[model samples]
Target chain A: MNRNAPGYVLGFMALLCAVFGAGVATVHYATRDMLAANERLNHNRVVCSAFGLPVEGRAPADYARAMEQALVVATVPDGRGGARSVYRRADADPPVVGFTFWGMGFWDRIEGFAVMTADLETLVRLRFLDHKETPGLGARIEEAAFLDQFEGLRPDWTAAPDRRVMIGPAAPTQAGNRVDAVTGATQTSSALMRFLNEELERLRALDWTSLEFEPLPGSEP
Target chain B: MSVRARDIFKAGLIGDNPVYRQVLGICSALAVTNLLANTLFMCFGVVFTATLTNVTVSLLRRHIPKRVRMIAQVLIIASYVMMVDTLIRALNPDIHRFIGPYVGLIITNCIIMGRAEAFAAQNPPWPSLLDGLACGLGYSLVLIAIALVREPMGFGTLLGIPLPARELWWHSWTIMLMPPGAFFMLAILTWIARSRTGAKETSA
Candidate 1:
């Protein structure tokens, strides 16, 4: 057999792909259940934290229970031909609405969750789930100093994009939604503000009362 | 150990180290070495991928067409990396969440492909496996050393445990936790390793 022959090369490549692909598929198949469970548990943990629920030293079962009692999911059109998840905390003293949002950061896409008042006006907390921002600079968005400012922030939805939620320097007396951007990370901070305002605008336009909500899987009704 | 095996280890560990000597896979070394725990997992993934890819590539060397050998090697490396990613996710979900981004990077780590091309393509299975392990360890050694210094100085802790009397003596050096810190540490480590080995690297 001529190894250099086109047919021979194609056959060899196909065989190799099949063999190695099968090996990887087998491993994935074996761990699919465990991975799914891990994702669910992690989701529960994040939702619990976002809603100010207890998570310290708690078991997976505990988080799942908390999620079951408090959380509901609703899908909303994400302007971009796709559906975005909106999580509503059913059991909070003043129910909270949480949704995942992502946008390009300085280096790559940044994904995070934001929980707002049930009325979707003021922010309760903002936390990042994944990012590839430059370490020590844009990555500082994950730190408390950067995120804490979001608490109690009320974006001026009626205002322009730049004025809706200002991330750059602002005085204490400055009006509208303002959070100090991470020093030396203007790009990331600005990028975050851009996507956040867009998401907030989208959320504000939605009729939350009209959107249907269902229990998160594995949660009690 | 047999003379052949001893020579392979010596070359991989020192003379032909994938990191300091060959200067391959530095992206990951720079990215993950800020934390010891992350570095350890990255090392395990690299070692696993390198060793298994070498053996498989060597086993298939005879049949793999020269025109598509690189593609085949990558496919093989990627499969192993996928397995490592899934296994880590299953075994330690928390760590996986932190290191998940880095796991996919193993397939692109130059060290694995370097071994497959430079040594594994011609060597027997056992020897290629050893060479892969040796090179992986060489890379691991450099990364772990950097992490050991970076984590303690940057975070005032080792493996997340606060250092003794940290409140009194430890003031975190912010640079040590960033990419610039990894650059300084890597340069220093490469300098030390090269000085001790007395081997000069020629530009390829």
Candidate 2:
């Protein structure tokens, strides 16, 4: 066999591809169920956390149980001709809705969740799920000092309402929606504020009053 | 075990440490060392990928055509990396998110490919496996050392334990949490290790 021949190279490459392709496919299939279950558990945990539900030191199974008992999944149109899924507290006297949102940060994608009041304007809590912002600078968006400002703050929706959540240098003094940006992370802060407000506008347009409870995909009914 | 096998393993850990001596895999060392937890998980991922890739490459070395061997080695390495990524994502989604991109970037980590070409392509399967494990450990040792200094200094905490910054009057060095700190730390570490070993620095 001529090892240097084009035929040999092509055949070897094909063989290598077949072997590795099979290996990766096998591993993916074997782990698929577990990965899906793990992702569901994490999503439930984050939604629970956003609603100020107890999740610390609790196992993922426990979080899943808590989510099942306390929240109902609702799918609403995102005003983009697409469906948006949100979790609402089943037991709240006034329904609290939680949804995940994503936006481009200074470095890469930043994913977060905002739990809002039934009126769909007031933020109950905000938390980041994942991000690639620079540590100690842009990454400060995850710090409680930054996120705490979003809690209980309502997005101004009156006539000529403030759609932009101004990220100021100092502590927010505006009665309308404003937050103090992280020092030195103005781009990330601005990006976050922009994305959150955009998502809030989208949520405001969602027909919350017409939402129907549906079992979450992959959850036991 | 033969003396050759013992020497091969020892070479990676200290005698010719990948990070300190060869300065390979520095990109991840700098990126993940700010947090102890991130560094530890990244090291484990590297170790798992390296050892498995080494064994797989060595086993197929005789059959792999010389002209296409590099591609074959890469294919094996990438497969194992995906498996590791999936496993980490399943077990700890949060940490998985933190290190997901880096884990994929392991395909470009140099150390794995370096060992495959230099060691696994020539050596037997068992020896190659040991060499790969040693390389991973060597890399991990250097990274963990950096993390030890960086995490506590930057965050005023060790593994998330608060270190009484207010009472102890210890101010966190903000630089320690950034990329430049990794550069300084790696430079100092390489200098100290080389000077102690009486090895002169080689210019690239």
Instruction: Compose the digit string of candidate 2's lDDT tens values, residues A1-221.
Output: 77878887888889888988898889888989888887777676777789877654677777877677677888777665677778888778677889888889998989898888888767889988778887667887878898889887877776232344566653347665777889999899888877877787787777666879876555676
Once fitted onto the true fold, the runs of candidate 1 whose alpha carbons sit more than 4 angstroms away are A69-95, A102-111, A130-140, A160-163, A166-175, A180-195, A209-221, B200-204
Clashing pairs in 2: none
- Residue A47 lDDT in candidate 2: 78
User: Model 1, range A162-214, lDDT digits (tens) per residue?
Assistant: 56788987655466588888989999998999898888778877887789999
Model 1 residue pairs with clashes: none
Question: How would the docking of model 2 be graded?
Answer: medium
Range of the 10 consecutive residues with the lowest summed lDDT in candidate 2 chain A = A159-168
> What DockQ would candidate 2 receive versus the native complex?
0.54
Top-lDDT candidate index: 1
Tens-digit lDDT string for candidate 2 (B49-133) = 9999999889988878897788888888888898888888877777876777788889989999999999999989999999999
What do the candidate models score in CA lDDT, each in turn?
A: 0.87, 0.83
